[model samples]
Target: MTSAPPTETARNDDQAPPPEQPAGRRAAPSPVWPGLRALAGLLRPQRGRLLAGIALGLLGSLLGLAQPMAAKHVMDSVGQGQPAVGSVVLLSTLVLAGGLLAGLGHYVLDCSAESVVCTARRRLTHRLPRLRVPVIEHTEPGDLIARVTSDTALLRRTAPQAASAAVTGTLITVATVVMMGLLDAVLLCVTLTVVAFVGLVVILVTPHIGRATRHTQEAVGRMGAGLERTLGALRTVKAAGAEQRETAALHRAAEYARRAGVRAAAWEAVSTTLSAVVLQACFLAVLGVGGARVTSGSIGVSTLVAFLLYLFALAPRVGQLVEGVGQLQIGAAAAVRLREAEALEVEEAESTEPDRPEGDGDETAPAPEQAPGSHERHRHPAAVAFQQVHFTYRPGLPPVHRHVSFTVPAGGMTAIVGPSGAGKTTVFALIERFYEPDAGRVLLDGRDVRRWPLARLRAAIGYVEQDPTVLAGTLRDNLTLGAADATDEQIAQVLRLARLDTMTGRLPHGLDTQVGHRGSRLSGGERQRVAIARALLRRPRLLLLDEATSQLDAANEAALRETITDTARRTTVLVVAHRLSTVTTADRILVMEAGRVRARGTHAELMARDSLYAELASTQLIAFR
Candidate 1:
């Protein structure tokens, strides 16, 4: 039977389901071939360098073929009692030249591979910020890092080495077989038969190697994700005395990775052992057959000896070829992961027009700026209107905003008060176009927000989130993030407005003090003030404050409230108020409940007309007393 829809009470913030884990390995069907293609595409741009490397490799292999012939000539001369010093010296020269050429070829191949990896990393980095917000929300941070770091590194180490070995080894094997035919066609047939059987076995085993490697890489990613989760919440885990449980969880993930690696190693061992066995078996077969031919005088002793030497040379090439195939499988698996990351949906590119400073003549221009402390203004502030806007986080989920409609007039403080799940934050998300409404329009200054260039539209707005983020840097660095060109005077003006000037003066280094990781060095109230100061420096036309005073004590909260009120006189202010005191004096108030605006008016009007609003006001008022 179908379950009933969730009731309003069931939709509380704490009860919402966590995001689903990605399907990962199971989601991929036929990952190997696609990964191989991706690898090829990545290297395609560097094909010229790759081809040069291949040519050099082939030259080195061909030169190597002459060594055995030279040795044979030297042996024949020594046996005949002729002068052999010249032959010996010639043989040494061939060995030295071939080694040098092969070394140069290997060097070129490695350089090309590194270049491909660098390009892949750059693309992944560039694509990250462009990905849609929902994609980022669902992805694990550590797993994403694994793709860019470990997985790409695997591709770099494996692709060119494998390609060069496979190509050079195959060519050398064919050339050796041809030379063997010239010596004796029957012996050539025997060698060909043995090689053909070994090649078939390697081909049959190759796909399993790819499958095992793909699983191994995925397990490593899972392990990384688990560790990141533990580290991110380490303090909470320790405080709750759940360290043992988190440790066990991480141990299990590590064990999973270990098992996967073992499985891959097992497959690789099998491939290597089979290649070794092929070489040994072929050597015995050639020795026995060639012994009979030498005894029967069908082939000369020296000729048979030279042919056996050539067969000996063929063994290593064949082994290298098989090893290269195995490495290719590993590379292909890594390529699959990289391709998956690159395939995420990215945000639409911003308009081609260059971003102009605020108050440009374009329709998206910011409101006129007033002096820092000036309250006088003649022009109207930017107006924000929501007309029947609708949104839901995912399909089949209940809407977060159901035909929501409201308007905030220019140049005043407008406060939003709501229960935890009443969708107060969704309003700001729509206005910022982080999300698009399903049915209706969100207008900025009477123009649909979607029509404005994304960059320019954001430039005219400043937002302070409830959980303020202060990066690991000096105070000045964090404050200047949104306004890189802010002068010291402008910086001081914002600090004064945020009531942070006093705090800065007390610090040992003032603005140069390090914030530590995520601003752990600062007190909660100070961090919130710093966030406010950062936003103010932008001089935005529309300022969004989401629970901006939640971390402040009574004194700081009151000061911030006054500062907000002052800011509203010259620019539009929309705040999601957690405490009723912050909005009691707001010029207009919006009371929201169950994803709808239940009432909108002055605080007194809301208390007199709306029962829910009256209940909320009384609850907070009682707590305050």
Candidate 2:
């Protein structure tokens, strides 16, 4: 009995479905100089504030330089028996003012750095969807995620902390060195040599930093992938009682990440400690030489005291330079890994126009055709055909499929049945162009399947895999997914035909009911019916059903069988059958064994001739024969 259509039900009577989540985001690496050049533009908007902040920082450092000098002035005044109250007041005020300026500079630079990172993330996120699918398939999801989450954060720190520190470090180092030179040129010369040696140490270490940091990031990506796999298969792990094995696997992955991180941290610690040691050595040298000069009256006590103050003033910048170099290595390493991911090759686009057959200028020439219909009607040049196809997953391994040849007539129910390793699924994979055949020509509608635009070709057929992936959405949305603009009456007709609407009447929202993640909310039979309804909406000329009704109970199985039989009369249906009950009623059966077609006949005919078919039918058919 045909029921009233779902559209007859009122709108706004059901709960609205959740919107689909946007795809994951990834970070892109910028070319070294070009990325830096783009970064400079981010500073332009706040240039006035930046200049003001930088000026303040310099003033602060200068006042800080004056504090010890002022102490020396007080010391000299006391020795000469003069009042030093005015010198003390001036030094204290300079110290207070410099502190405020330094604080303001840091705030401005930090704000600018955040703005730069935000701009970079927005641009990269926008570019991701436009990238070709093949490139995305080849990349690791965890690696891409790390670029957006971790790598971008690292860059944010680099902009303000590393860049600004290096600048301030430079100005202070130069100013302090000059002040020391005024006191005694020999001591200043020794200090300059130590600073140069520290720079050499940093430069030698920086290159290693980039390589080590990249390895660490890669290890982290691998660990994330392992964790994701374990979580996704949580149910399987629990049922198989393999929790211990899974835990061990994850621990191994985490250990790899730890090793990489340790290597990077080791280099960073050594570089930082060595720089501090270098600065302290300079401090000792300045004190020793200046003390001797003061004793000989070559330099005054006040001059020697001021020189010692200058040495301490230079320390932060020297340390900052060391830290900045270390950060540069990390950024470089991350950039290289990101670049490696981005550089994967994409599948070449199909040509819009194919070359004509040689010596065939006629538009309607009768091409070499297949056998005239014996039991077939309206043969239509074999909807799909495989010629001389030979495929192997890897070189030197035995071929999974060898020299297979067949023609599937358009517009009928054809069933392919086989044992476990008969390569039944590989045939479907080739038809869908998932993996290119090593040596074969797969023809669809009389032309090479690869020649067709990937989107256009896929749209022509409706495919339901063995384990149908049901995305989270409303029951109505799943039915109308392939044809969103389908009319309410047409949608209702399909739902009833697929037997999904029978369950919908029991649902609170009928067709508008929400199916949870992966359609886990729906029973197995309901999910299969929903998938059938979805394919029916497309009105596809070719329907590829892989174990389409395998999950149904006895009552639901009968309903699905009726639906498949009814649809077969109007469209071509190809199904992979594991149960003999399904194929016994099929119009024709192709028995596959060892990747080759062993027999082709109606059920009774195959049972009479083929021992494999006879044995399989008796055991698995459930008396349907």
Q: What lDDT score belongs to each candidate, Candidate 1 first?
A: 0.80, 0.69
Residues 34-119 of candidate 2: C-alpha lDDT, one tens digit per residue: 44444455445556655666676777777787777788888999899999899888878988888988888888767766775676
- Per-residue CA lDDT of model 1 for 189-230, tens digit only, reads 788888998798788887888888888888888888888888
**Total backbone collisions, model 2:** 0
Please state the error at residue 301 of candidate 1 in Å.
Answer: 2.7
Residue pairs that clash (backbone atoms under 3 angstroms), model 2:
none
Off by over 4 Å in 1: 1-17, 23-25, 29-31, 351-380, 506-509, 621-625
**Backbone Cα, N, C clashes tallied per candidate:** 0, 0
Which residue pairs collide, candidate 1?
Answer: none
